[model samples]
Target: MMGGKGNSVFSLSPNPNHLCISMEDGSQSSEQLVVDDDDDDLPPIDDTPDLDIDLEEEEEEETRRDEKCFMAPPAPGMEFDSYDDAYSFYNSYARALGFAIRVKSSWTKRNSKEKRGAVLCCNCQGFKLLKDASSRRKDTRTGCQAMIRLRLIQFDRWKVDQVYLHHNHSFDPHRAHKKSSSAATKTTLPQPPLHVQVRTIRLYRTLSLHTPPTHPLFQSSRRLELRGGFRALQDFFFQIQLTSPNFLYLMDLADDGCLRNVFWIDARARAAYSHFGDLLLFDTTCLSNAYDLPLVAFVGINHHGDTILLGCGLVADQSFDTYVWLFRAWLTCMLGRPPQTFITQQCKAMRTAVSEVFPRAHHRLSLTHVLHNIFHSVVQLQDSDLFRMALNRVVYGCLKVEEFEIAWEEMIIRFGLTNNETIQHMFQDRELWAPVYLKDTFLAGALTFPLGNVAAPFIFSGYVHENTSLREFLEGYESFLDQKYTREALCDSESLKSIPELKTTHPYESQMAKVFTMQIFRRFQDEVSAMSSCFGVTQVHSNGSASSYVVKEREGEKVRDFEVIYETSAAAQVRCFCVCGGFSFNGYQCRHVLLLLSHNGLQEVPPQYILQRWRKDVKRLYVAEFGSGRVDIMNPDQWYEHLHRRAMQVVEQGMRSKEHCRAAWEAFKECANKVQFVTEKPS
Candidate 1:
């Protein structure tokens, strides 16, 4: 018999008794066979299994081929006892066909978070997620449509709802089988070992400072595609959870199983947001990684007037859908509390998303944007800077909503902008973006962006930059948090010990200094200094108890009129409000109201005027579920603060006697040496 692959044919040689088997390789072999009468037919060989053949191996190969029959794609009615069983069935099919599969996504019922169905697809089915220049895997995703859909059926059974087998790229059995790339990575707990775990960690440490962390498969000098690309990302998240269990992350996946957006907030970030979440500022263009994924930072102002990152997300694109996902995820992470007010970071998508997700949320554009648009987007204005400054004054110093409306109309007419679409649009949306119109709400200084000379969030300007990889971005984010938290800790210490000189003889200054933070005290001092701008006050009308005054105030090169109402109806309460809306806009007393109080001989700032949000000794409500700081990963500030108090106590007791002092110093040195030795010791 001729042993070869493919079809074979038999032929007779010159010798009638011999039979020849011709192979496709052009080889001829013969075996003796009995010919029938008249030489018309040959007898078949005796039916027998060859003793030399491995029947078990043959059976296994046959079984594998049978499983590969599913490559025609599983039938829609195919049923399984559980979702895992369903996944395993299709995974086996993919294994036999030589490709990878992953959970594309899971669908949940409307108004619920419970997953109802699962969509699994080829690993390389979706468009490339990251835009890394050196990524070899960029072309791996050929938009393969090979996938399976699993639906939860009656009696808790999972059934195949759909199957697609067409592949855009050629696949073979040798392709790595990544059946459990991301879902199987549950190393959130401390596991002793993974494949080459120690070696990978050592390599990561050596290269991480200079280069971005990459998959172990891509650690070579030459770029290589990741095997189970998202496995590493998921592992990274778990590793952080190992240190900080309160690290909240939500990922949005494409239909083809690609990660589209990711949002994260740590325990500390949650605590900060609870205090500062009233006003959120998000900028999508803030920072980017090596892959060019847009880093969206949700930031807020701390009591120190420093910008703090409240939450962060990496979006595939700044499209409407992506922003909607970001907003929803952040809202969920913050426990469904929408920000009272927000200023978007010059992206229209953000604004649109905020409106869609949090429709009730009051959104406003920064004064900077309105001015910038007039100066750049509009060109008809002859004195753009002059007009901008004039508009800025009216918005800032105007006492009533009517005053702003009149001033805006006057500017349009003066600039011959009656037909200008820009001015007309601004007028149409005045109630939406105008600060004077939004004075009744609490903003907590949301309006002071570029105007306040506030510094940018530390993460964007200092920690991360262009060309940062996912690994590097995370590391930089951690470093960013560390630096900011450290600064705040230090500032807290300084504020506790340092005292500011009195800017005024009024007792209100002393009261503010005692409760307000040093930064806020300076803001209060600015308002105190502006009291001289109050020209005079004339009584408008008095009902023997309620009195109103029309006051003149100096603003730049002009004098503006403001009305302040003082109601002394009840001796227990002296109700007052200035139409300037400074207190409501900025959470502090306006200069106009302060001027009136000063003239009335009132010495102390009202208790309501001092906001708890800006109080120097504001208490923090920490949700331990948001992470209580595991023993291994204690907060550095807290550690230092507690240790410092103990050390100071030791120093105080030791100073009582020379012998005690020597003993304390010696013990400290010995403890330090031991700690140093333990740190230097290797695992």
Candidate 2:
């Protein structure tokens, strides 16, 4: 056999019976096979001349012929009886080749009689049959055995191995098999673990002069308790610093050198701290030495009567900036929003801090401080009534802006105080103080208490003996006037009086007296009128039944009587009727005659005349039912319950109705089922 161009050729030589192959380039020659096919009786030849002959082709073929050479092949070792045996053989071969190999068993079988099995090779690369059949010599002999029927060819070499099985199947058995005998192999790298980091933060200073009662550091030991006993004091001081720093400072003034007594600070510092601080103090005792306690807290009622707490802390004496900074920090922490109004007794420190921290809040001087200054300015007014009057007008009266200006000018003139620098200084700030007196309502009652107290003693002092308080004087005055008017109406009979109580024995006498008194005056006027006429005789009668008058008129001795019957009972009854028509029309009475009959003790007054105009009875009206049993006019409870029960029944019956519908639907479906679907031919 010869391969195409430039290939080695194999041929049989006649002389030596050797198979020889020549390299296509004629560079080498080798013997491949030696065969002894020559014997004397081998064959008989036909001695006839052939029709065609090619001598040149025969000579060329002889020249190209050469002995074929074959190298020694691999030896056939023991066949693997099972995949495990095949895997062991391949792994050993791979190890020798300096490469690792793994094999997995795919399927297994065993018999009690023979102890034989077959398996599939499942190396990493591809699947292959490891064994057709294999046997164990004895039942006790336990070893995996199989035959390997597949091999891998790679490069110029071939590898034989069992296939690798993953979960019961081969995984790339072909690659594993091909690489089993290879010198080069890939390796896997190891993986690393992940890492994370965290940090902590703190918000405020943790150290304190006083630890809380529940501090974790203080366990059951009394020593810990003693060490942390100052914690409560420190917390109290801190709270004082937060709520009212100035009050805290003022209290500290009395204890000069003591650590708890830092109140006697420098004048400048004290003044700076005092601004708006007076408003924070509920009472003057907060500064007094009477209470020895280091911490004091109380609510200060402002002009509007709102309670504000005075909180103070006693700290060791510190610099002005240190105190101010501490106060600011305390305030910012304690009050989420700044104070709306701040009053002080002219302290510089408070004024400075308030201006900076609470610019929007109203800042004012305490009225007490202002009054003290005012007394000094008006020393001459101690005894003068005119001076007192002027003070009252300017400071306590219902003084308008213009009126106050006039009164202020009069005071300056009357007191001869215009040239006095002190008074001028006071008047210079008149606009601020003037509002305190001019307005009826003030921001703080504390500021206006002196003026209001002075005005109270004089109001409603004359005529009325009642010593009414100024606060309720107006209401009391109006009530007193109402009682006085009621007394005056009782003394004067012409004016209406409250109804007189009636007695069963003479029930109608009082009512009759009222009516008869009115009628007698009317009858006297009619008799005078009759006497003035030429026909003069007239009889006037008032028996409390009704007013009656008869007039006699004569001409030449012929006389006629003219009678007038005024329906008093009808008019009185009409007045008592409750339709209020009489009150609406003439503000008095109507002609319902039942009142007169009742007043005279008549049991059964004629109803026809009493209710004449109102004879027709009003029909009773009712709401009508309009829908089909949906609405009801009577037995509302039964109606609602009936509807509710009917709704539930309808819902319950819906399923049965639906079932009936479903049965009909199924019948329709059966009819539809009977019709067979067919494809029709087109025309």
Q: Best TM-score goes to which candidate?
A: 1
Instruction: List where candidate 1 sits over 4 angstroms from the true fold.
Output: 1-239, 286-293, 345-352, 379-382, 416-424, 451-459, 462-472, 543-545, 556-558, 568-571, 621-683
The RMSD of every model to the true structure, in order and in angstroms, is: 22.2, 46.9
lDDT digits (tens) for residues 294-386 of candidate 2? 222222332112232333333322222223433443342232344444544333444454565557656555454555556656677655556
Q: Global lDDT of each model?
A: 0.57, 0.31
Query: Backbone collision count in every prediction?
Result: 1, 55
The total number of steric clashes, by the backbone 3 Å criterion, in model 1 comes to: 1
TM-score of each: 0.58, 0.24
Among these predictions, the greatest lDDT belongs to 1
Candidate 1 residue-wise lDDT, 1-683, digit = tens: 00000011011111111011111111112212221121112111111111121223565554343222212234343445556556555554565556666667666555555445777777677675455546664356677877766655554556555566678887644442332333235433232222211111010012223333453311222111222233345456556655653456654433222234556676566667878777877764443222343567888878776778787776556555566667876775576779888776444555666777788777876555555555664555568777778777777756567878888788778867789766676667677667778876666766664432223233366554554555566656567677887887676666666898987776777888888888778888888878878868788888888889877888789888888988774654666788877787778898888888777777887676777788888745333122222322122323432353356456655764699899999989998998887754351
Colliding residue pairs in candidate 1:
290-468
Model 2 misplaced stretches (Cα beyond 4 Å): 1-299, 302-308, 313-330, 347-350, 380-389, 419-422, 436-444, 449-683
